[model samples]
Target chain A: MSETPIAAPDPPPGLSELFLAFASMSLAGFGGVLPWARRAVVEQRKWLTAEQFNEAFSFSQLLPGPNIVNFSVIFGSRLRGPAGAAVALAGLLGPPLVIVTIFAMLYTRYGDIPWLQGVLSGLAAAAAGLIIATTAKMAKPLFEKALATRSLDAAPLVALAVFFAIGILRWPLPYVLAVAAPVSIALAWFRR
Target chain B: MKGDGDILLTLAGHFALLSLFAIGGANAAVPEMHRVAVELRHWMTDRQFADLFAIAQVSPGPNVIIVTLIGYQAAGLAGALVATLAMCGPTCVFAFYMGRTWERFREARWRNAIQSGLVPISIGLIAASALILALAADRNWVAGAVTFATAAFGYWTRLNPLWMFTAAGLIGLAGYI
Candidate 1:
């Protein structure tokens, strides 16, 4: 694997530009925003390389709140500190907030229409499927890496334990993470 | 029902705490959100909660916007704004500071170990989220079929997910699913 040069030396984005970029991303994102975010940040803006984007996104996933929201904060702050984060977040969320609110109001008024209910039910099911697909795609690589490196992989096992504890057993998430995270980290340390 | 101030305060406080536990994004907190909104507070019915989640999913931007809808249902526009900010604020601050210092530990062994460990945990969280949402959405066999088909298609195909969403909606509209 070729090493990415440290700091590819891209020009820093202005606060307003950051705002516009995120605002446009939010506006265009219909089903989800992550794909659009990748297109803009990695392909269009050239702000982060594909590998860097993956690393940043993985790190963002470890943080609390929405992955994309955390991503905007980390990306913007990397460029221009706290103020940049604020602006980028505002841009990302502001337009969608207004649009979604309007949609909510419309649904409140007319949601009882039978066809709309049918449509919603279908969409909801599809949404659940999308989540499942995402989980499968993410897990595949981890499982592969685990088997590739060692005959026994603690990472995939810990993950399955977490899935069972939370998904089937219905344990409280905070407590599960509190135990699982530290244990898994230690396991990785030992394996390393 | 509670007064607006009480409701807003409750909404803000609850969502703020929820935001911190959202390790795999807002969806990870769905069961907890369901507990607080449906069972504890009676803010909305189970069906209503489900509908709001669907709306949030269909609309643009992040999944966290469901909190805005929940807050709006509970306490109007102010509640929506408060819930949105409360959900995003604390974590944003944390990410901002972490981003500044993260580069310093790029090669740290502990950091690598933590990252390796956390990947599976996060994947597990996402799987848990899918299970929760599937149980919530699949109210009947037909809906269950839609969900199963969609999952299969999404996993095996390279098609954009929006098409699945659209096709499912149309199927529902046609009263087939």
Candidate 2:
């Protein structure tokens, strides 16, 4: 993947620039911010290669907390240090927090009307559907790996087991993860 | 009723704990959030929880803003600030440290194995989250149909999701759902 180097390189952004970049990304991101973040960091700023961005994002996704928030922290820390990380996080979340708080106030004031409730319900249904679509897209890589190998992979099985245990059975999360994470890791280690 | 300080502290503490388990993102913690908000604390009803999630989904920025909404509902603006800070703070520190060290382990076998293992589990958690949200949101046959259609559209087409969200909201406003 790294066989061919790009022809030109851009200077890495300073901390203030990083803050502005993430703040704008968050501001423009109406439904999801990850796509906007990728565009800004990889495409516009050229801070990281596309491959590097994917790696950082995947690593961030594997960690706790929100994915984009984690990405902001990781990317900022890579550029500078704790201060940069804090700056990036504040950039990404500060504006959204204010906007969402305003929304909360509006909803509380007018949420009791029947028509607004109906709209919210409809929006909720569509939002649920979007989540399902996102899940399928996220799982596609595992399914493709299993297909290419022409063998039933343990990863998909482990995933299904987790789905059934929590999604179907309604088990508490910590207990399920306590068992599933280690088992999945062991299986991968053996397979490797 | 609890004091403002007490409410803010509790909000901060609970979200900080949940932050650790947010494997695939804050969405992965929805069911647990539901349990805590609706069942345990009586902060809101199931419908209110679902509606707040929808608001977060439709709003700009990250979907985790639902935590902010929950905090707002529980203890006003102070609760919101505390919840968001708690949710993002500890995990951001972890990510910062890990990012610094991650390149050092670029070729490490154990790192690769751990990454591969966590991918599927993260996908599973997201699926569970989708299921929980779907159950909460799909209240009627029309709502169910809207959800199914939206999923199909999202999967099959590269169209912007905002269109679907707008369409659904309009449908609801028109009393279709």
Candidate 3:
């Protein structure tokens, strides 16, 4: 790819705005933020274009931290410069700390009740749908790329198969992952 | 609880394992976390795991906040602290130290291969987790409908899913399902 200059992201509304936006999304995110993140950053705020999001998202996935954190870095760096990364990271983590502490307390007390069970069961299931929809939409273009590339790539297929076996089949997932994870790492190491 | 020691050990184990596998985000390694925490250790049930995850999402910190909670629940304050440190400690050190070097290798073929591989596997694992939740969560027609419809509706349509989440919650609240 030829080097093309990146036009700087328009200055954000402010650091506070960036903080609030990230915090709001973090607090509201129930299952995961793949959907909400895309919605907020891409569509709602128009902070980044559809194409820009696609590129950033790949990096977000590849980097070590949570994709959302990686996103905050890129998004924040774009908006606020170096300091922006700090603001975004802080905002992303602040709310969840308090919320999870309280939640942990409550969970210990009333976790096994019938109604709560029903509620969470429903939520978890819906969460599944959310993941499916999110992954499908996220990967729709990638899948198309696979077809265009005219190759049945082993990576996604193996990961998918392992997940099905472990998560769906309820196989001892650790065993499966232990086997596969290292192999993939080694494959990358050798291929490198 | 059996004691603090057991909890600390569990926390240590989870931290080590999740750190190694938690490449993308806490969620990326969740299916694996579920395996170790819920299945192998039986430290928490699937529903418990899901419940913790809910707590995790609603928290103010990273997705890994659940690790702290899980640790706390498993052991106590010490557990929580240990779990938090274990999970974040290694990753943070590595991320910082290798930051420049890793960035330099960003465009390398092996990097590309690993990433390309992670994508499909992540999708599959995520799908499998979703399917598993479907089995556990869908108990009745309305519940099942909510699950499937929410997915299809969210996917095919451009409607925000939170609205559907509320709609489903109301259905449950009404005692209809």
Listed per candidate, the RMSD to the true structure in angstroms reads 3.1, 3.0, 4.9
**Which is the better candidate, 1 or 3, if ranked by lDDT?**
1
Per-residue CA lDDT of candidate 1, range A1-192, in tens?
Answer: 124322433568888999999998887777668889899888998888888988888778778788899988888777776887888899999999998888778777888899998898898888888888888898999889867877787888988998898878877777888999899989988984
* Candidate 3 structure lDDT: 0.65
**Candidate 2 Cα errors over 4 Å, as ranges:** A1-12, A144-150, B1-3
- Tell me, by TM-score, which candidate is best: 2
TM-scores of chain A across the candidates, in order, are: 0.83, 0.86, 0.64
Task: Encode model 3's per-residue lDDT on A54-119: one tens digit a residue.
Answer: 766676677664566666766666567667766776677667766676677777888777676666
Better of 1 and 3 by DockQ: 1
Per-model interface RMSD values are 2.1, 2.1, 3.9
Off by over 4 Å in 3: A1-25, A28-57, A70-90, A112-114, A142-156, A168-192, B55-62, B76-78
Better of 1 and 2 by lDDT: 2
The candidate maximizing lDDT is 2
Candidate 1, RMSD to the unseen true structure: 3.1
What's model 2's lDDT at B120? 84
User: How accurate locally is residue A18 in candidate 2, as Cα lDDT from 0 to 100?
Assistant: 83
lDDT of 3 by residue, B1-177 (tens): 556687697678777656655654776566666666776777777667766664564444556677778776777668777877677655544443443244446578777776755665566656666666566566677777877887887789987656766666666656655
* Lowest lDDT 10-residue stretch of candidate 3 chain B: B92-101
Across residues B1-177, which tens digit of lDDT does each residue of candidate 2 receive?
Answer: 648788788888889988988777887788778767877788888888889999998888887889999999999988889999888888988888777666666678888888888878888878987898889889899999999999989988998999999999998998877
